[model samples]
Target chain A: MTTTPLSPTQRTTIGRGRNRMVEDRAELHRLLDDALIAHLGVVVGGHPVVLPVAFAVDLDGPDEDGTLYVHGSVAAGWLRGAADTTVCVTVTELDGLVAARSAFHHSMNYRSAVVIGTARIVEDPVERRHALGLTVDHMIPGRDATLREPTRKELAATAVLAVPLHEASMKARAEGPVDDAEDIEAGVWGGVIPVGRVFGAVVPDADATGPVPADVVRRARAR
Target chain B: MTTTPLSPTQRTTIGRGRNRMVEDRAELHRLLDDALIAHLGVVVGGHPVVLPVAFAVDLDGPDEDGTLYVHGSVAAGWLRGAADTTVCVTVTELDGLVAARSAFHHSMNYRSAVVIGTARIVEDPVERRHALGLTVDHMIPGRDATLREPTRKELAATAVLAVPLHEASMKARAEGPVDDAEDIEAGVWGGVIPVGRVFGAVVPDADATGPVPADVVRRARAR
Candidate 1:
């Protein structure tokens, strides 16, 4: 099925650097899939507070529109204030560091997705459970199946919010650093050094029932 | 040298979760140094905007306080709007994904530094150049010495802002996921899968005049 792209508004539009915009809906999904965490921006008391939270995107809807899921503690109260207000959720994957010979041209090669939407608080008990399960499964496939679902008391302590992925945009810079003519003639080492995340040594918990599960072992290699 | 810790307003205070608070100045510097990118929060036109930007922290000041430098193009005007406004610059390093048997207990092991301060535009050309040098060298050491300095025209096109580290605080969670009593008894595989960044194969520029320099080669290994 063909997916409609996210329509951009004045804030979502990349007016300054147009070349970095990624308009494809599928590409946005790919970028969000790889992101381990997302920065949720909310205006509190006339100031902006950006906090990192474990996030997941639900893509099973008919429009192929993405639904961003984020959760925090009731005590933290970050999501509580976010209800009904406009919020910006951004995910960035730093692909590499661009080392241009000219200091002015030095840059980073990264893929970022910016989504602006209203934060709809998940108040319904049924929807809350779904969002929580999606977060666990999104981070690690087969995780939700293995683990027990959230209990009523556990769900009461958690707060989840959803943002429609309709008004979103992805911006990426993947090419090598472009050094100017004079700097190239000066003979500096100019290139792109790829930067990426991978799995480090696993630390099993005290309650681990067996060796690392096969799902985790496979996920490690892919991560 | 001992640095005076940041005085917190009601908003910056970690009253809800005081256990995650880090008060040491030296530890905050180390957290900022390890961040791949920082999310800069600014309130513009009654809305909050969080954008990822390359950033550096200079801890060589006499007071042993860090000065954060974040640069953007004059055209984008992000850093421009930040002048004289309260801004929040946050750097997060995701250490691992904490997998708990219960969905509610799933968490992320991360170290995040949040600096809330008023931005001061770098008007002095001398200080501007120094901050830019520190940024480039901090990301990739020894490259600034080789590359040509920014010309006046180039310098004019860039805007850099400085936020003192005095009001900054670090919040980190570095333990295994906390599974509840019932789920721990359920005997699901619950543990922590460490996550971190590394360098992929280097891609040299097409016009390279010599082999990749020793610094870049060394940088790749440590990346």
Candidate 2:
């Protein structure tokens, strides 16, 4: 794994003209870390298929550039077909709703990262187990520590894929909506409405043995 | 324009090992309506390309099934190439985080709609105008009534593509984490933390602006 920042390949470049590209590699990691789900796109059965999946990044590795770990049941047809193939994982965080004076100029202030790489299924038992641990920790800081480690049978039932984060790029539009010069005087209200994702109150399970874990409560309140 | 409820083709069925499929048409509509952006996927340059775009649905249409309107600059190379080609538009709403006792069952409570159809670039003057109107109205309800409608030149500079909502399906997994019986007694807390997307205070654009428009305030508050 290359610890260096991701260098944009031709495929990762935004070639279509609206150049709202983010050049920093750290920004890409920030967007990915803050995300809960990623839209995973793969060419399946001769067409493009995009599905949302839970994902985590491997920061524990010594490499500066980390791998994205996405897991599912071994029996998932999509996961089975996705391995050893190019997959595009996209994470988008919409910051604000840009309300431009002109309808044409209206846009959203969003930060989006697109990571394209071949997903390789982890075959090594030790690596798979570690990846599973990282998956839970990524979603919640102190989660994996408290849960029971996966048994050998449990591990066998799951499939985890490691996607290298080499070919990646981030694009964002993060300012107030740009209105036309003439429309500024058109007496219309134009501004940006901050769009925030926050975690609400915790809903305990029906048969929980105790109160919500301290870490869960802390993370939810922080959000 | 098919007014009948959308009839799913073979492609829309969930054939994977674990099926959290939703067969309700109304549920699909609800997910699409409440979303801010849809990841529109089309094979571009011989690879799967997914782009986030602002979209609107035409429920007011005579067809029982609706259409998804996604607009972009006419100069956009991808849009020009995407016309009359099969496209997959997916809208996802992450409702909560399901923290199962075991890491394997940890999942997200989400509602997603996937629409597969050939996107048609609107050409007819009337329909093109209507599609553009739907695009703005979808983002901010009752917005176009206040802002100046697109001029002839502005309309010519923009391209709007309408993808039929006929071949569509919804899938969701909204429940508490499912942990094993043994893990339940292991005493690690298991529950759900509801995730909510809310709009924060509005930031008015520079220069002359009256009070924030009632409609904008209303939309922001409703979110």
Candidate 3:
């Protein structure tokens, strides 16, 4: 398989009227890596469907292209139909908004990535195993070794799709709103209302469990 | 302007391969209302488009016959197209998954609402005012009164659409996996793992030198 690095496309633009689109892979990776959940948009019967799913990032192995691997049941209607089909996967973090004096200038300060590409299903056993390993590790590093291996039957039912980080665009807005020079005279309550996510202390299972995993503790606190 | 209340005929059911379907409005409303954000699926050029947006519930002023009014900007292509067009709006919250002994029975515990309808644009000033109020209080309850009233210029630029909650169906999977009788006999590491949003302490604006509002405090802890 040829690994094609993504280039900025004609559709990626910044602001309301198409002003600031960032096509850098590093910026795209940063936004994707930081996001725990993503909204997956797929077409079913000509109507659009969007589903929020937990995803894992694979930065190693045959997926040397830094592919984002998302999986669901092989029987899942959305996943089953997505294979070899162009899918739009968006990861958006609304960091803040530039509330400007002019309604025309109102814009959100966000870090968003739109990946448009054909998703291919992982078929090989080795690749599937590797993908599953990456997924488990990404969800909770070091949990793969502790969890029981999937049975043959379990492997048969699972489905994993790989969407290359190629064809992706990352766009962001951070500065205060670009108010019209004329609008500046209009006293409006305008400023950046920052948005963020915070994780609380991890609540360990109350059952007769062994000592808490250090990795889990560290990651939870970091969040 | 007509406010239509959707009956069962307006509802659509999305089924898994063959077995289950849920059709309930109360369940749908709770799921949609609980979510902090929604990914609106719109189709452009016969392709699927999905964008994340914030929405609020309008409870005080019913549209004619107690229909739930969901409002947004007229400038928004999605909202504009949604009005008088067949659209699908889905709201989902993945609480967790309940693993079971049988792989086939492994299930996620989630609350989801999928509404299919044509949105109506509210042009009447009296109705529009109430819809705007709902949108404002939906985010910050008392802020509507505290903030400056919208000027005619602001209102002129804004557009609000209302989608009735009538023709919506809510589907949920909230219990432990229903493993087959044969699988139930087999021992497996199976149970539900819960997930949800936990709001942090309310952060007041640094410049807001006044006492913390009671409404803000109540809403923060209510969540």
Q: In terms of DockQ, which candidate is strongest?
A: 1
Each model's TM-score?
Answer: 0.95, 0.95, 0.75
TM-score of 3: 0.75
Instruction: Give the per-residue lDDT of model 2 (tens digit) for B85-136.
Output: 8888888999998888887778889998888888898887677778777777
Off by over 4 Å in 1: A61-64, B61-64
Best by TM-score: 1
Q: Comparing 2 and 3 by TM-score, which wins?
A: 2
Put down candidate 2 lDDT per residue, A112-148, tens digits, no spaces.
Answer: 8888888899888888888888888877778888777
DockQ of each: 0.75, 0.73, 0.22
Question: What is residue B126's positional error in candidate 2, in angstroms?
Answer: 2.6
Q: Quote the positional error of residue B223 for candidate 3 in Å.
A: 2.8
Clashing pairs in 3: A14-A20, B74-B159
Per-candidate TM-score, chain A: 0.94, 0.94, 0.84
Report the TM-score for the A-chain of model 2. Answer: 0.94
Model 1, span A112-218: residue lDDT tens:
98888888888888877888888887777777777665678888988888888887888899999887787788777789889999888778898788788766666
Interface RMSD of 2: 1.3
* Model 3 chain A: ten consecutive residues of lowest lDDT: A200-209
Instruction: Report the Cα lDDT for residue A4, model 1.
Output: 60
The DockQ-derived docking category for candidate 2 is: medium
Q: How would the docking of model 1 be graded?
A: medium
Off by over 4 Å in 3: A1-7, A14-24, A59-65, A93-111, A171-222, B1-11, B17-24, B59-83, B94-109, B173-194, B200-214, B220-222
